[model samples]
Target: MMSQKLAASCHCGSVKFTVELSEGGFDTIRRCNCSFCRMRGAVVVSAPLTGITVLEGQERLTEYRFNTQQAVHFFCSVCGIYTFHQRRSNPEQYGVNVACIEGISPFDFASVDVTDGVHHPSDGSSGGVVGRLLYRPVEKDK
Candidate 1:
């Protein structure tokens, strides 16, 4: 799989960054069912920790953590939009929000696998996909 570099920013454009996606690239996109994730509801793609660089507005970013506090979520303080997160499942990788990436949207995928974050693998449970989110577009009559 080839890696791709993408530009990303918060809704308000207060935070800007560049991300070099992991080898799996868009294939790594997924949704988590954790408390925070369920509320934020952002589709994410994987990138190595070193693959992301803050291009601007680093001071406008804020960190959020909860539960085990292993995963560090980053968002723009101005727009309050989640930009990326250090994955608890894989500390070496960050989950970059697809919505924040240029030319990408969560609706682009027809079906996205939802990870069972409620029963996290780090908690000694077999964390597998519990369900999938499907996007169906209605066609307009001519």
Candidate 2:
């Protein structure tokens, strides 16, 4: 597998950054039909919460939540760019919009697993999303 670190940023470029992607290969990413997700036209760059780090713009981010409110959407307040969202289904997972990534582009949605956020509420808790992701290998890379 090819290990690579991807750089991503907001539309205005005020929020500059980088992400160390999983080398095993990352998913093609998915587009949601949910109310909020659909409108934003965002794609998810997932990794465990611990794996993701905001390289900059810590103060420029604005968070928004509604309804079950487990999902927290992070946006660049200055540019009004919805860069990523904390999945309600899995609080431990982050769904960063692939479109915002500076270096890479996700072109295949058919290959990615589609997560139905709209109907997740029926799943009881987590609305079907995983709670606090824990993704790592048993062995360390040396």
**What is the C-alpha RMSD, rounded to one decimal, of candidate 1?**
1.1
Q: How well is each residue in 1-142 modelled by candidate 1, as lDDT tens digits?
A: 5366789999999999999999878999999999888999999999999889999999999999998989999989998999999999999999999999999999999999999999999999899999999999999999
Q: How accurate is candidate 2 locally (lDDT)?
A: 0.67
Report, for every candidate in turn, its global Cα lDDT versus the true structure. 0.93, 0.67
Q: What is the lDDT of residue 49 in candidate 1?
A: 95
- Name the lDDT value of residue 120 in candidate 1: 96
lDDT of 2 by residue, 37-98 (tens): 75776667675566556788879989999777788988998999987777776687677778
The residue ranges of model 2 lying beyond 4 angstroms of the native Cα positions read 1-3, 22-25, 106-113, 125-142
TM-score of predicted structure 2: 0.73
User: Quick one: best lDDT, which candidate?
Assistant: 1
